[model samples]
Target: MSNLNKLDFTTLEVSGRNYLKWVQDVKLYFTAKSLKATIEELIDNEPANEAKKATAMIFIQRHIYDAPQTEYLPEEDPRTFWLALADHFNHQKDIHLLEARHDWQRLCFQDFKSLNEYNSEVCRI
Candidate 1:
């Protein structure tokens, strides 16, 4: 209470803004992925016949199969970051197949057992 007058909020605000910029820089978020060069390739070569299955496979591979393979593992806070991304991808795929696209062919693409089975596997607290 007595020390409140001594605080310099300007420094704190600058540091917080810088920290947020740094976070945006390194975060592999959707915005960054949207700007990636591979998006066009992925969209163009998207398997129309088995898009849902292929999407599920890609999600599984990227999240569960590829995440821990790297030397620099995910930190504790988002150790299962890959899984979360995969969940997002899976949700998007399901929505595209079942709702937005409204493809009757996609009606049979609900054979995604892995995504359904291991949606959120609790590892670290």
Candidate 2:
């Protein structure tokens, strides 16, 4: 269906702030399209597999920001591009974890005027 072909989510940005969510979205999309194999493994010389790989690569490149597009322009295989993106952005998780720990450490019981506000902050952090 035409609706199924339309992209309905945000693209991955250069900042890597949305890397985790982006990866999840990409996986789900690829799975729905039956193209997950293009990123999950090396493709053989079969024409169908080659077409799927091209589709997957185009989808990924179209969903990424300009900086990453230029940087990964030379990459031809979707699997390699996927792994390169993971290698580049996986550190975002550690950075986010450290920031969350810092916020949790700085949280004070008496800082909020209401119990609900304090609880909300705790959930957010």
Candidate 3:
């Protein structure tokens, strides 16, 4: 509980622009807390303890932006909540990938006023 105050990463945003990085951060944090099993799809043998699931729920609630937090407030199982979030964010990630691809396809050196500007856009894409 004391470590909850030390949020080492940005909260998951409703816009999901940072979803990929947020997923990575969440996985690392869960692993560190031995709560990874609460979010995993398969169990080796035994189910995750209720206390661990509750702790995971609290951690997820704390690390997400307010809109999603409210939307998922009724959720009781951490694994189910985690899957729902993953489904939404995976779609978001695909949309961003398509947009980036479109931008890359349309990119042209002559479209920019300066070489640096074109380079910057390329880097961004």
Best by TM-score: 2
Cα lDDT computed for each candidate against the true fold = 0.33, 0.89, 0.89
* Candidates in descending TM-score order: 2, 3, 1
Worst 10 residues of 1 by lDDT: 7-16
Q: What's the C-alpha lDDT at position 22 in model 1?
A: 27
Among residues 3 or more apart in sequence or in different chains, the pairs in candidate 2 whose N, CA or C atoms overlap within 3 Å are: none
Candidate 2 local distance difference test against the native:
0.89
Name the runs in model 1 displaced over 4 angstroms.
Answer: 1-79, 100-125
TM-score of candidate 3 against the unseen true structure:
0.83
TM-score of each: 0.19, 0.84, 0.83
lDDT for each residue of candidate 2 in 1-125, tens digit (9 for 90 to 100): 98765665898989999999999999999989998888885357533367888999999987898999899889999989999999999999999999999999999989999999999999998
Candidate 3 residues 1-125, lDDT tens each? 98758777898988888889999998998999899999997676778999999999988888888999888778899999999899878787788889999998999999999999999999999
- The pairs that clash in candidate 1 are none
How many steric clashes between backbone atoms does each model show? 0, 0, 0
Candidate 3 — which residues are off by over 4 angstroms? 1-5, 113-115
